[model samples]
Target chain A: MNLLLLHPDQRLDGDRWRLDDRQATHVRSVLKLAEGDHCRAGLLDEGTGQAVIESIKNNEIEISFKVDSKPVFALPLNLLLALPRPKMLKRLLVDAASLGIKNIVLVNAAKVDKSYWQTPNLKGDLLREKLLLGLEQAGDPVMPRLRLAPRFRPFVEDELDQWAGPGRRLVAHPGPFPELPRGLDEPATLAIGPEGGWTPFEVALLEQQGFGCHRFGSRILRVETALPALVGALMRLP
Target chain B: MNLLLLHPDQRLDGDRWRLDDRQATHVRSVLKLAEGDHCRAGLLDEGTGQAVIESIKNNEIEISFKVDSKPVFALPLNLLLALPRPKMLKRLLVDAASLGIKNIVLVNAAKVDKSYWQTPNLKGDLLREKLLLGLEQAGDPVMPRLRLAPRFRPFVEDELDQWAGPGRRLVAHPGPFPELPRGLDEPATLAIGPEGGWTPFEVALLEQQGFGCHRFGSRILRVETALPALVGALMRLP
Candidate 1:
């Protein structure tokens, strides 16, 4: 973990906090920090600062923290992704969160397996856990908002247009579509497909909502790999 | 696997091949291919074609193939990376192959743990297995060449100049470096550091070798996340 992320509830009094869970284990075992050493710390949804180790006993570590600065601003992007397989979903959650994407909609798609929705990884707490890991990795404190839309049609037809307000709406589909645009100064909503990609009808539906189809060249990348690539490309736009 | 990769020894006749390993399992169980079913197939370092399932018996599957097209051209990019932890190394091998990067040099740095070189994942067969998985995912047949440099100084001082030929020689370092350049039609060499980043001495050595430093903005990403992002940005330059 790059940063020790503490929840609001973990506060003791004033600038003091305690951790006895995975963070504690990381501080004790991985970091091997001594009592007087300081480690980077952030409060969930709050801000980041330095935490000085005060004492350690019985597998719990107490630290005194001083809030230095608020979390980095969220990226001006939202992701509309076809729910990937369970294994890929875990990594994407972490990847997307680490990239500073604040809003994500995991919508169902034609090729998405129904069984994927039943995976324990999609459970609320489990998903949050993955997102937290991502936050720690990026040394950010803000948590991204994740919305699940198990049905494809209703979400796209009824809610997508209004939600993706006033921005470049692009869907990543493999075909002779236009290359991804550059210099996107405004917010952007990027829709990425499932493993087999979006069916034609799904592409049409998104297109009707102003989602221009774009190709990331010929090589089809796994969702885990594609998320960072696409996000990086968008972030690099002048 | 998106494509059934066939090795030379798997050939049973001019146009026929047999498989009894994991590929066979994937065909029988994951794909559930029947005798008459056809699936995409690629010959190792050769070409891609279609495979018709001829028969399935005694835990073995036989197929008829026809060479159709050569593998996709390799990306005009080379990667110089500080060896990541073992788990990330496996994914990166797959990722670099999938992205069509043909050459990779994994070098040691100050922050890289000495034990990382001892990882079983770096074993030849295991590394090849990961690359194969990547090629299959990308529907490409050619494999990437991996070079290991256990000692950093010699690799940078002696061999790097010849290896990283003309065009952009950029090292991704966090700090006051220029933004990554864009719109280049020439071959580029990208060097990425390890978890804690490159030390000043290492950066200076690379600079003396004519490597320019660039930053991928402020957010700190894991090597797996950063590789795709940087590669994507470079690919989108034009």
Candidate 2:
């Protein structure tokens, strides 16, 4: 808990702010912070700054800080991923935010079970909780933007055009399609499939949109394992 | 466990094998193997084959295998990594084996603590334990070959030259080095640094010997996170 993230409702006046029950408990209990001890705080979508503890009691705490500096860092690129299981999704949210991903689009893959979307972790508050963990780990005060699209075809065809970055688009597939171009310093929109992977029709649709089918290796990797790998590779290019 | 990996001592006859106290417990308790149950078994240096449970009783169990095929899906590249923390190292060992890496060259890194080498996981038996877990996950019978070189300089300049393959060589560094080449479809040798990463001196030495420095992104990554990312990126390349 490097940064104590506060929801918008927590703000009080000018430099003063109030923390919710959860964060107040964490600061008072886990951090053992006392009056005069400074702690970091951020408002969702607003900005970040240091907050000096004004008082702490029960499940409430008061803080003061200069709220000018931005509180977080979102990744330069947007990630559109197929929703994985709850446990894995929790880790993904944290890791993605820690890496400063700006936007995440969790779309439905054909193999995605309906039960996965109903996981408690997907709840707005819980999702924010996991993202905050990542933000704190990365020492960023900002939160990554997240969007859920339960339907795949509509999201890809209707919304994908607006999401593609300035450079080439690549889709990671099992078998080889083309070699990842070298010295690719420009921003790119890369797509990774689900555990069972994208079907032939899905791959064909993506290909028609100029998304090249590419593979990382012959070995199969779980989604949690694949996301960072793809990001690292893309980031490595020029 | 997908594949049960055994040591040389476990092999009794052409097809018969004996389970030690620990393995016997895993077979009986975890897997709940009974007479005539089918399993996969692989020798440390030999091939993988199907095993049949002959009997299960007391503290020991008897099993037999049909010797036919060799377990042969080792990664296309060799991984030269600095020793990470004991816990992460344990995971790395299992992941390396499961990912089908044949040789793991553990060297002392400038940032690596001297105490890490003394971890029980580095011990022969302990290391084998993790590799067995990896083999099981991969459904492969063969275990990976593990090697340790106390010094980084001597090993790379001397022993490593012999195993260097004919392709791009990369070192994970967080510097101004050009983005790593994308779409690597050929054989290569990749080197990873310790927690704090390689020193300037080490980087210069490595670069002098044909290794190019590659940075994943601006944010620093833990060693455990870096491995799969680098491996995935390289493998994704054509």
Candidate 3:
């Protein structure tokens, strides 16, 4: 964990904060911090600063913070992704969140397996847990907003206009089309399809919505590999 | 499976070839091919074309081929990587091979665990299996060349000049240095460090060998996530 992320409610009396088992174990074992030692810490969606270990008790670590109140590293792009298998879903969610992508809409596609939507990972706590792990790895305080779109057609036709950040729209498909131009000037909304890729009808549907079709290359990458690659290629890295 | 990959030795008669269990199962269940059906197929490092299914026996499938000779999509970059944990090693080998990276040298660093050098994944057959899976996913016929550098100093001092592809040399370090300048003009050699990153001594040793330090961004991405991201950011995709 790059950052010792503390939730707002974890605040005890005054500047003191209490950490749960997860963060406590990380601090104790990974960071190998002792009483009176300070580790890089942050508040959820608040700011990044330092935390001094005050005490280590049963299942919790008490820390006193010195923080500056502001969010760190919110990515400009919003993602529209086809739900992958359960295992892949876990990895992508964590990776995408770590990349600081501001928003994600996991939508259904013709190539997506019907049972993928039934996974427990779609539930609240499990989903939030993955995002939190990502946030901690990034040392970022802001949580990327996540939404689910189980039905493909209605989501694109009805909700997509409302969903997309105001910018260019693109779809990652099997292509000899133009490359995703580097360093997009505005926030872009990119739609990535599932394993078999979008059907012709699905691609046409997205095209009707102004989602320009493109490919990174002819080599079809796994969704887990493609997201970061596409993200890095689409934006200018700081 | 994107391509039905065949070994040249599998050819049994004038136009007939036999498939092992892996390919036979993929053809029978995944591709659902029957007699007289053709699938996209290729011979190892030889060429890509099509194969016609002749019959399915107990453990093998017989086929006839018409292949065109040439390797597809060898990436114009050589990678100097720090070996990750076993599970991650599996994914990266597959992904890197699939991306068409032509050469990889897995090197050691202070932060790399000694046990990582001892993984069964370091052995020959399992390592080749991962690369073949990646090649099949990409529908590419060429296998990437891989080398191991268990000793850091000797490899960079004695072998690096001969190992490096002639052009710009880079090391992916935590940086405010500069973005990996987009699309290099010639073949390039890029080195990536271990999880906690290269120690200053390691970086300095590399710098002496003309490896310029660079970063993708401020975000600390996983080795798996970072490889594809770095690869995508460094090269212009087709």
Highest-scoring model, DockQ: 3
Looking at candidate 3 chain A, the ten consecutive residues that score lowest on lDDT are A66-75
Count of clashes, each model:
1, 15, 0
Writing each residue's lDDT as its tens digit, candidate 2 over A182-229 gives 334556677777777888888777777678877665555556656776
RMSD of 3: 1.6
Candidate 3: list runs displaced more than 4 Å: none
Ranking 2 against 3 by lDDT, winner? 3
Where does candidate 3 clash, by residue pair? none
TM-score of each: 0.96, 0.68, 0.96
Pairs in steric clash, model 1: B183-B237
Candidate 2's clash total is: 15
Tell me how far the alpha carbon of residue A153 in candidate 2 is from the true structure, in angstroms, after superposition: 5.8
Indicate the DockQ of the complex predicted as candidate 2: 0.27
Give candidate 1 misplaced runs (Cα > 4 Å).
A183-185, B183-185
TM-score of 1: 0.96
> How many clashes (backbone atoms < 3 Å, residues ≥3 apart in a chain or on different chains) does model 1 have?
1
Please report, as a residue range, the 10-residue window in candidate 2 chain B with the lowest summed lDDT: B229-238
